[model samples]
Target: MRQKEIQLNSDELRSYIDSVGYEKDNLLEQLRKETQDLGDESIMQVGSSQGKLLEIICRIGNFNKCIELGVFTGYSSICIAKGINDEGRLFAIDISEKYTSIAKKYWEKSGLDHKITLILDEAINVLDTFIDDGLKGTFDFIFIDADKSNYIEYYKKSFDLIRSGGIIAIDNTIWKGKVFDNDDQTQSTKTIRDLNMLISNDPMVSQCIITMYDGMTLCLKK
Candidate 1:
C-alpha cells in the first residue's frame, strides 16, 4: 500500500519538527523575539523553518544573484545572505522604512550588511527598472512575499528577471487555506488561486506548492 502523507496536525508534532528539521540560529531566535514584540505585525515575519529552508535552497542551488520583494524584519534576508558566497548580493526591496529599519539592524548584527542592498520603493517600480535596464534573465533566484493583490504582477516581472533554470519562490500561496474556498472570492484569495491555476497549466515552468507555513510555491523556470 502507498504510504499516507504525514500531517503536522498537533502542537507536539510541530514542536518535534521544529526541534530537528533545522539547527536553530541564536541570532534568528533573537530576531524572532524582537519581531514578536511588535505584536500582530510580527506575523508578517517568516517562520524559522521556512527561513531555514530558504537558506538551504540558496546554498544548494549555489545561487549568487538574488532578489527579495519583501524584507519585513530581515530574518529571511539574513538567511538568504548567509547561504550565498562572500561576493554574492541580495537586492531586498520594501516600501516601508519603518519595518525595514528593523531589518537593517539585524543585517548588521549578522554581519551581512554588505551582501544585502535594501531598496526603499514600490516593488513594481524596482522590477520594471530592472527590466528597462536590460537585466532580463539575469537573476538566479527571486522571492516574492509582498502585497497579495500584486502577486501576479510580481510573478510576471520575476519570471522576466529570472534566468532559465532559476527559481522563483512565492510565499502565502495558500493564503491560510483560503485559496480552495470557492466562495471566498476576495481579491487576494482570487488572485492567489488564479496564479496557482496559471502556473499549474503553464508549460514554461515546473512548480510545486510546499504546504509549510502559509504555503510557498517554488517555480523553476524551464
Candidate 2:
C-alpha cells in the first residue's frame, strides 16, 4: 500500500511561527513547567502550537460538545478547552485520576474547570457508557491520543459517536517515523498504519494526514 505523508516545509514553519506568536499564554507556560516537575514521563505532551491549533479547530467546528480520548496530564485538553469553553462542553477520559487531578489543578487555575468534564477510567470502557448515556452523535469534534494497541477500535467508536461533518483528530499516526520501516513491526506502528489505510479508503470521510509532531490524522465524517 502506498501511504501519503504530510511534510512540514519552510513555508509551514514560517506560518506556524507567525500564527503561534499571536499570543502568550502565561498560564499554559506555568502549567508546562509544573508538569515538567512530575518527571518527564508525566509531562509527555503535544507542542504548544498543536494545542493552539486544537483551540482554533474548536472555534471553527463551532462545537460545544467535544471528546478527548487521552487526558495525559491534561495539557491538550486544557489547551482545547481554551477555545470552546465559553459555551461549550469538553469531556476528557483517562485511567489515571492521579495525573488527571494534576490536569484538574491547571484547569481550575485557568478558570476552565466548569466547562470541562473529566472521567477517570480507561477510555475504551467509558466510551460505550458515554454512548449509552446518549453521547452518540452528540459531539462535533474529537481528539484521540490514547493507547496505540486500541487505536483502530477508538477510531471506529469515535466515528460512531461523531455526527456527519464532525472532525476526528488523531495523534501519533506516523509513530515518530516508524511507519515507513517495514522491518520494524512494532505493534503500535502497525496498528496506526492499518487505521490510516482503513480511513484513507473509507468513503465516509474527507481527510488529510498531516505529518506534524509524530503525525496527526485529521478526518471529517461525510
Candidate 3:
C-alpha cells in the first residue's frame, strides 16, 4: 500500500485548515486583529493553528509549570495558559514593554492575567536567573520563539531548566524555508540550521519537527 502524504501548498488548503482545524475563540480573534494593526511586526505573532497546537500539547501533558521565552503580544502565552491546569503558572519573558503591554491587555481580557507572570528582561538573563534561583529541571514546558540568533543559547539554558520528560517547543525552525538554501549563511539561518542538526543527533532527547504554521520542533527531554 502506498502511504498518503498531504502537503499544504495552496492558499485554499491553508484557509481550510484555519477554518476547521480548531474551535475559534472570539478572544483570540480580537487579539489577532489588534496585533495585525502593528504592521510588519504582526507576523511575529503565532498562527491560530500553532496556538491551538500549543494548547493541545499542554493539555495532553497536563503541564503546570510553563515558560514562554518570547511573549510578543501574548498569543501563544494565552494558548499555553488556557491549556494548563487552573492552578498552573506561566512565566512569560520578553524585553519589549511596548509589545507585551498589548499582551497584558489581552491576557486580562481573556481572564488569564492571574495565570501568567510577565517578566520584562533579556531572555538569557531571565533564563540564567531561573537557574540561579534553583529552577533547574523543574519546568514542565517551555516554548521558545525569541531571537533566532540566540536560539542555541536559549535551548541550552531551557534544557537545564526543564525536568526529565518535559518538552521544549521551538518555533520557526524551518526559518521560512531559508534553511534549505545553502547560500543563505545569515546568522539567524545558520543558527537555526545548526540547532536542528544538534537536536537531531543529540541523545538527550527525542524530537520531531511538525510542519505546521512555519515549523515547530518539539523536543522531549530524556
Instruction: Give lDDT per model, in order.
Output: 0.93, 0.84, 0.95
Candidate 2, residues 1-222: lDDT per residue as tens digits? 998664553567747765754466888878777778888675367767778888988887787889899887788898788888488888899888877888999999889989899988888888888778887887888999988999999999999899998999999887877788888887888999899999999899999987666678899999
Clashing pairs in 3: none
Inter-residue clash pairs, candidate 2: none
Can you write out model 3's per-residue Cα lDDT over 56-93, one digit (the tens) per residue?
A: 99999999999999999999999999999999999999
Query: Which runs of model 1 end up more than 4 angstroms from their true locations?
Result: 1-9
Task: Write candidate 1's Cα lDDT for 94-177 as tens digits.
Answer: 999989999999999999999999999999999999999999999999999999999999999999999999999999998987
List ranges where model 2 is wrong by over 4 Å. Answer: 1-22
TM-scores of the candidates in the order shown: 0.96, 0.88, 0.96
Which parts of model 3 have CA positions greater than 4 angstroms off? 1-9
Rank by TM-score, highest first. 3, 1, 2
Each candidate structure's count of clashing pairs: 0, 0, 0
